[model samples]
Target: MYYDLMQTGLVGELLITGDNDGLKKVCLIKGKNDFIIPSDWIRDEVLFSDVKEQLGQYFKGNLKEFDIRLTPEGTCFQKLVWDALTEIPLGTTVTYADIAKMIGRPKAERAVGGAIGANPILIIIPCHRVIGSSGKLTGFSSGLENKVLLLEHEGMEIKGSERSALVM
Candidate 1:
């Protein structure tokens, strides 16, 4: 059976879901109706204790990498993109094209973007670390503001009058 938990975070409220195997989702709740929890899911704080703790440490700048096992659901290509995202160093950012190359599909930047957009486990998967080719902040499932916050929290400088450019 799937278990879930609600935890307040830096970006917003996070809905964490998983089972005994590993975590399945770590979605940011933007509004009341942003996500619908499955009826079969049960609320279990005990199951997500480690997740909460690690996330708290990450937000406080005490942790750089997560040790939790994740089992996000997605197509094989999407999983490949997400795996590459995990390889991104904590304080560095890469373009979508970089991810495409990392997965051996150097010409599939747009496809990589789509897969990155579909990532279910946000911070843990490190999708926020992907930027545009011009070093500009790009789309993030949680929004660009949160993306900047995360990057800055990791010690990356964000420049540009619109707060859309990265100094990497």
Candidate 2:
């Protein structure tokens, strides 16, 4: 689990070392702004390169789905939660508690939130789509503002009660 710290063409970027596939996935959320990714986790490769190119296109409203594979690390329950995240449609959204129930860990809503927060792959894992049970966006290791922007970029309606509104 490593990430490269680089500000490519996006607001903020993270290049994650694919632990399972050797295929790094670059994450560009919230139009690419405001974050902290462990710089020591970087592995130099063209995987992240392709990911960056596609992410740029995706953010610019030119591309929809990303053709990237991920090998994010986590617990069995967490993996279940993250996998559920990937099933979320490109432009749709889901909540942490919702994810909890979906993974058959209904009482683990808080646990689900924990796993969502622990998500290492960001965009590809779709952690940004997991909002608060109240329909409010919350707790992205990448930041809440970035979460909102990602939702909007995916054409979400902002849920009306959104707080920061892209606090960049």
Candidate 3:
């Protein structure tokens, strides 16, 4: 396994941990915080250059979509939720209840949110696109500010803590 940490201009630090087979996790690094890199993990810029480039482009609003291979570890339901997240088009948002219905568990909105929170891959998995049923920006593992920034970066219309929606 290997890992590389990348810091974007707006999104801050990102910890990308993975193996040769595929990516395992990509987490946002909070302020001034440090993480223990495994002894076996070697820092390789080349290994994650594409992700860095894509994320950079995304932050700049030059890229609306991502084309990267990811292998996030989670339970079957979580995997299903994560996969469904990818189907959410750029510049659009969906509610947790919507995801629950998509997965044939309309009564499992809270469970869907739980799965969303467990998503190891952030922007690549599009978990930020999920919002509250009332159209308000909800909890984001990466933080509300970052989530708002990301939604703005994607051209999604966001109002002052009161509403969240796509422009088109």
TM-score for each predicted model, relative to the true structure: 0.92, 0.74, 0.90
Q: Give the C-alpha miss distance for residue 27 in model 2, angstroms.
A: 6.0
Model 3 lDDT per residue over 113-153, tens place:
99999999988899999988777888888888888888887
Q: In model 2, where do residues sit more than 4 Å from their true spots?
A: 1-10, 23-45, 159-168
lDDT of 3 at 50: 86
Model 2 misses residue 86 by how many Å?
Answer: 0.3
Query: Across residues 64-154, which tens digit of lDDT does each residue of candidate 2 receive?
Result: 6667776655688877887888788788777776787788777888888887778777776678876665666677776666777777777
lDDT of candidate 2 at residue 161, scale 0 to 100:
45
The lDDT for every candidate, in the order shown, is 0.86, 0.66, 0.84
Instruction: Order the candidate numbers by lDDT, best to worst.
Output: 1, 3, 2
Top lDDT prediction, candidate number: 1
lDDT by residue (101-156, candidate 1, tens digit) is 99999999999999999999989999989888988888887888888888888999
Candidate 2 RMSD computed on C-alpha atoms after optimal superposition onto the true structure: 4.8
Candidate 3: list runs displaced more than 4 Å. 162-168
Model 1 residue pairs with clashes: none
**Cα error of candidate 2 at position 136, Å:** 1.4
